[model samples]
Target chain A: MDYCRSGFKPKRSLEIILFTSEEPTRFGISCLGSRLLAGSEALAEALKATVDGQNISFLEAARSAGYARDEDDLSRVFLKNDSYSAFVELHIEQAPILEEEGISIGVVTNIAAPASIKVDFEGNGGHAGGVLMPDRNDAGLAAAELMLAIEKHATESGSLDTVGTVGILELYPGAINSIPSKAHLEIDVRDIEESFRNAVINKIHKAAKSIAKKRKVTLSEFKIINQDPPAHSNGSVIKAVVDASDELNLTYKYMISRAYHDSLFMARIAPMGMIFIPCYKGYSHKPEEYASPQDLENGVKVLALTLAKLSLR
Target chain B: MDYCRSGFKPKRSLEIILFTSEEPTRFGISCLGSRLLAGSEALAEALKATVDGQNISFLEAARSAGYARDEDDLSRVFLKNDSYSAFVELHIEQAPILEEEGISIGVVTNIAAPASIKVDFEGNGGHAGGVLMPDRNDAGLAAAELMLAIEKHATESGSLDTVGTVGILELYPGAINSIPSKAHLEIDVRDIEESFRNAVINKIHKAAKSIAKKRKVTLSEFKIINQDPPAHSNGSVIKAVVDASDELNLTYKYMISRAYHDSLFMARIAPMGMIFIPCYKGYSHKPEEYASPQDLENGVKVLALTLAKLSLR
Candidate 1:
């Protein structure tokens, strides 16, 4: 509000669109922003993908979208075409890079995408007391090995940009007195570099196969839930932001974003870039999330200058 | 039914009670038969005890038990108790003991109870992408280690009589893209000797404590979900079964019953004994579950003699 109040305006006419939406997709879910402006092509692509083991269908979205069949409400919801010439997003770094390096601004190189992976481990379930150690094929044990294997493989894989997470582990017939027959694990792997992500994924698959064979359990292939390729920043926007930061004499770094943003979708239609200011200890989506006032002001000034230069284009 | 068709009734007119009920309590709720037979005193004790984390109140039981109440026509249910002088149950040996040893009959010594243990692991949840491998207190990873540790501890433990199973493993905020904030594990530890079960439990607790400390995650002590102490077969009943096995010249072993039976509760009412026959590959509760006719016949004959002797007493 203060920045808007200041009598600072870009060279060309500026339109500041304020949006009131729900929380960020906490990793691609039933969200608001992305789905609204992503356009039909992207929506169709997303609809073709699978989420939480369910196929996302255009018909389903169409059904839900038309939930308010009353004329007045449905008219309000419409998809508009590619409007903006160029887009720039200013956000908190959501990581320690800028603060750790004491940089006032971060010129985002690329935004990484999460690769959802599910590994199904199947073994024979039996009475805990009846199934002896030597004879039993415990699926839970196999799953445990897979979790550790993910940590090992992800860490050892070529790129530090790669990250693997085994978040949801569910045991079928999950009883206190029965040996786990089926273990279902949901893993999320991510990397800005597609090849690096693929490499980490390959290692994970190999480990799962080896562990399952060794433990006498069946391992399912990596089920890709939802995966989008990394979105690279526009060169023009990047150059403008760099020049702006230099003019203001504020330290800036080119950093790849481990997190996703709305600009990823916008990048399809128009050139998109993101300017990031530091947050306290990289704490984001937390109560203690903070950014130094001076650093934020410095980032704002850089962003203003970048907008001024981009408007001229 | 065939065993009853033999028309070899005990001298004191025998009233065989045939019962049909729902499957075993997967997590200790919505089951019948045993609790009804157990007198008010025993039922009171059971109600006070927590089974699979549900409070055993009469109100809750009545509500679930009356699921069939809305039916237009249904058979009325009744609970009759303390009705017999002696109760003897004949079952397949779910364990490999009799089949491995080639014993015709098993003179049951005692039925071991499952020590239902639940380990609650609380760790700080964060975005899997944002949290680094080193900074993360990943509960899922810790749980994986615990699962393997259980397998190691149980297998390496002294007696084969002791069995540990981590059946149900649940990860909190179980999204593919979120770091597991908490992991709740249901552990079932069974042993014929009370001391051995306690020892194994102690070892498990110690291991959890150690793991939690190393991983920087918080570990809570084992919360006993439900525990039914080892039920020793009646001394006179054991002697009678032993004598019956001897008279038939069938090799028998005094075996501990790892599986539960109605007689586990019947022991509180009368002199209770169990006869175990060998099943193929020690498979029970499975479609392939099969007991040899010869072994079952041998077991039936022993059971008949034991009943005859007890009836005479």
Candidate 2:
């Protein structure tokens, strides 16, 4: 994993390689992931120099110039029984990390899951003035109570470490003069453990049911959306990374991800690990989000050296 | 004063007189109270017949129609001296009574004051998931508490006759996942006594202030969109109607208004009294709200006869 930085700038000529080990490769179709050109190209060039009689072809480029699925498949060159049967995906640190830390590489393990759930409470809307509290059904109030209970549930379950969140809840006929007749809430729960995730889900349903009963309102639960739990970096891949870093005498630390990245999904399909480069302010997902070119270069060099070792094996 | 409803319907072209007699003229203006058409026509027709005159005209018609203002001219026809004078105003019941009970006329002594207020609470909005109970202010919950307090205030006002109603409440970004940062509510309160009305207002303000402090949020109060006090009917006019009903052998009862009508305002300008005919099923405001034609005729007849007595002066 020994590498050096040229400058904190983006070079247009950087070559990016996407490996699936299949001939006539299509990149995005299976376990979709993005491969930035500079890192991928650097790794591909490094591997080309390390392997004997390696054939490299430049396929139709992506709209934004990454090695995306359907563009190339590495299965053509490597197979289950082939000497070089392993898959390695190289990409730029879309997020800045090592650049600010003045480190050249970052090793990642796991990513948090993304999810959204909807809870609906139906109740009768009537005159607040005429309806006695004991007789009236209020959905908004039910939702409020349910939200507080949910916060308690998550806190009690110690799920805050995994960070379950409630993002949006809405009521109908939201008029100041009308008692809320119906309410809908969206809860966002995410975690690396399936059991912990399911517990949070169960807690939400229980809260919804009890709140509905207490408010004398009808409540229903539905899964609006969810994403798979991100795969972990393979043990062998982590060993290779640590060995390569040791061989290069590089200072390194193992890390887990709080955010999602293409590597999260790729880890499921192969022995995958990511190398992060420091970003000035850790900014991403915005126009102003940026990373230093020198960090990018150092990150690419680590990937290149790591791939060189894998190619040699 | 005796006016005839000939058969069941009175399409009679009656002569209306213009008069300057203090009693008749004062009665005419009082008659013009809140129910301009009913009171003015009643008095105008009666005066015409008394003077045996045709087409009586008042110079203040434009002013009454809101076309002009009779600011300082006090010597005009019915405008007389600038001293305050009062008259007895008689109103035909807009609400049902005799018609539903098989009676022709029902006298009312008072009108209930209707108060409608809009309470809007404003606060800062933030990420619902990021903000915890103690870290943030919640206007929606505060609004709910305020609503409950309003009910409690109305009940504790010590006037069993008092009534308070919250008809509408709305919250900004009223999503289940988001903490409500702002809330708006509409309150309607009414009572026969002014003291009770003031008390209810005071309680509402007090509750709002306390809730704001408790929630660590700011609150602002404004005049009720509609705030008019209850009006008392004229004792003399009530007696006259009762005596006339007895003499004419018309079925009648003494009652108070449960709903507001234009006559509520007229009662304030003059010694006022009302006669109610029944409405079928107590349905008054909806499109299906109706009173039988026979009930209408009987009400008109009683009203016509009552007018005849005061019109002759």
Best by lDDT: 1
Q: How much is the TM-score of the A chain of model 1?
A: 0.77
Candidate 1 C-alpha lDDT tens digits along B9-127: 55566657664332446335312355345543444445433344455444354447764344321123323444667789888888778899889998888987667778888777666
The sequence of per-residue lDDT tens digits that candidate 2 reaches over residues B1-313 is: 3333333333423333232221113332322333333233444444333321333334344346563374523222232222112233333343334445767767877776767777877665443433333445667666767766776787778876566655456666654334566777767676778788778988898888888888787886544665667888777677778877788787788877645555565454445667776765443323435666866776666666655555554
lDDT (Cα, tens digit) per residue for candidate 2, span A1-313: 1222533232212234453421112321212223221123433433323322233233433313564445343323321222222334433343334544666566766555544677888776543322334445678777767666655665566554344444355666554334567777766555666567668778878778887887799985565454456557766666666666677667666755545455554454446676655554443332445566765665666666666555554
Worst 10 residues of 1 chain A by lDDT: A18-27
TM-score of chain A of each: 0.77, 0.59
Summarize candidate 1's per-residue lDDT along A34-146 as a digit string, tens digits.
44455534444443342423554433454576643433233234344457667888888877778888888899979876677778998877778787788888888988999
Deviation in Å, model 1, residue A42 alpha carbon: 9.4
Q: Measured by TM-score, how close is model 1 to the native structure? A: 0.77
Give residue B230's error in model 2 in angstroms: 2.4
Q: Name every residue pair that clashes in candidate 1.
A: none
